[model samples]
Target: MTARKEEAGPSGLASALVASGALRSDWLTTFNAVPRGMFVPDRIWPGIADGTRQNPVVDRVRDPVAWLRAVYSDIPLTTQWDDGSHSGDGLGQTPSSSSSQPHMVFSMLADLDVTDGNRVLEIGTGTGWNAGLLAHRLGGGNVVSIEFDPDVAEQAGENQRNAGLCPLVIVGDGRLGYAEGAPYDRVIATCSVGEVPRAWVAQTLAGGLIVAPWGTLYGGEAIVRLTVDGGTASGRFTRSSAFMRLRQQRPDLPRHDVYLKGREWPADGIGSTTTLSPAEVGGWLEQFAIGLQMPGAFWTVERYDDGTYTLWTYSTDTLSWASADHEPGADAFHVVQSGPRRLWDETEAAYAWWDGQGRPGFDRFGLTVDSDGERAWLDSPDHPVRCTDP
Candidate 1:
């Protein structure tokens, strides 16, 4: 255990959250009762406000002040890296689990819109902070949290017990909703998913809400709040998010060598020049729109020392690939595309379409999940985005 800092306590954090409008009056009691520090482990990698980058480790035993400060801060704290396979003081290859940012946590809970006697099913227990909040608001028996990792579930259970909150922390795949606790009034996912699982809809009662971070395999992510209605669920995105992808839904992307297939740069690939700046398409909203339009594609950037980078886009099938060389202040970017699919052409077309459509932000977009599968629409379910490959 670490000594608490005077400025880095639950009261200060609660006040900050309330001032930010993240902590509503109804949920304030739970927020204050179940402190984030109680749920967080002694050691953690503190993430930035944007949730893109993470700082070095801060262990309570070595640096309690830093640890407490991180806990109370609005940013996220990465608790486990590389699915717990990583060890040491330095950062890991990937951040597997984390105590999500406070603003995001409370905002998502607010989107959940749960009431007294409402049963909640939480996906991804993580540090049990979210579950503890839910358990405190709605009785412990009314909250059920599913965790894919046994170790994480164990630790979350321990945290909940220590916090005097006992929400059922089940060790199971979150994609498969806990049917034993069927027909929950509210469902929330801490982790993001490319597609809304059918089980979640089936497990939710009619008119119940499912709030989650829904994103694309490409890059951009946003929090979507869907309302279940019979067999179909539809709702608009609430805010932008960058949560870890659900474990089962994580894509197995093809390597660069596999795309090249023993060939060198621009080997038998059609080359062209475009006025579309690669930098313009790299923005969060641009990526979201492009990802929605181009379903099976994803992108990466290869940076050079001269302040330029090559933007590479690849299809999930590993057969199609495109590269656009982006130099600073270059009017025309060089493009190369191979495979049967004209990836660069398609991406450019998608961006143009989005631009023509007023480049709508996340709030204007909505998702619908039903028997036919999921489709993202602009405003209503009638005007769905034309997905190249669904």
Candidate 2:
């Protein structure tokens, strides 16, 4: 084992969470009862505190102290990679399952506002820590968790059993939501989704709450708390999030080669300069507003050695693409756009519109899902953002 200084324990971590206003007073007992350490695996890729980046793996048998510290820390720990298909000591292509950050767990639970006897349906039981907490608060019989990965579901079931919690764990698609547990008083999804599955809304009883992380293809995500009523659900966003997306709702994005279509940089494209710096539109709130305005669009960052970067935006249809060069301390930025749609122009317009609205944050935004479709709004449901064609 590599020699390293000791870190905070579970008690210290709990104290810190309480001080940070994440662990509520009402749920303190459950938090203490269902320790996250019990559910986390021995080998894990510890994630950074604020971002999604994960460090190298730490094995409990090889380095017990590091494992303990990772478990007690507020950050998330990636347990399985590539849907448990990749086997290695190093990181994999993508993180498929993980134990969510403790702060996000408690905050979303607070949003759920579960009662003593309220039956709960949880989607994506990755590590079973959430299911254990729900079972500790409400009885085990009242908590049901659904996981799409069979191995993940089995591991979660084993973890819950070892912790003396018996929450029913099922291996199935979360989008369909377990119908056997229909008419639940509360429904929560650990995964994010672009569209709220109608099954979830249909399963939830009227006046119940459905809390899930909702994001756009353009990037940026937030926890949405919707109240169900008469086949409709609408609520305001509680906080920003970056959870893994639901498998069924994942978008099919075209490859860069397909977008370029064998053409070189700026092939048959228009070139222009903008006074607006590309850096200004990279914030979490800015991305949320821009994504709300422009559907079916996504972005990526290409960095250069000289501390400059180009922000590339593309339509899912692989028809339009835009690139804006951002240099430090520059008032004007160069832009190149191609195809029928002008992505950069639409993005800049959305940013301008958001600025005109006093630069509203995530709290001001809300989402409504009904028969027509899902619509993002600001301040109120009636003021829906104008959706443009891709």
Best by lDDT: 1
Cα shift from native, residue 201, model 2 (Å):
0.5
User: How well does candidate 1 score on lDDT at residue 111?
Assistant: 99
Clashes of 1: 0
TM-score of 1: 0.96
lDDT of every predicted structure (CA atoms): 0.91, 0.90
What stretches of model 1 exceed 4 Å from their correct place?
Answer: 1-6, 48-54
- Could you estimate the TM-score for every candidate? 0.96, 0.96
lDDT of 1 at 185: 93
lDDT (10s digit) by residue, model 2, range 1-390: 996643567787788789999999988998888889999999998884222354788999999988998899888888988778878987776678899999999999999999999999999999999999999999999999999999999999999999999999999999999998788999999999999999999999999999999988888899999999978999999999988888777777887778888989888779999988989999888998999989889988889999999999999888899999999999899999998889999999999999999999899999999999898999999999887876
Model 2 shows how many backbone clashes?
A: 0
Residue 371: error of model 2 in Å?
A: 0.8
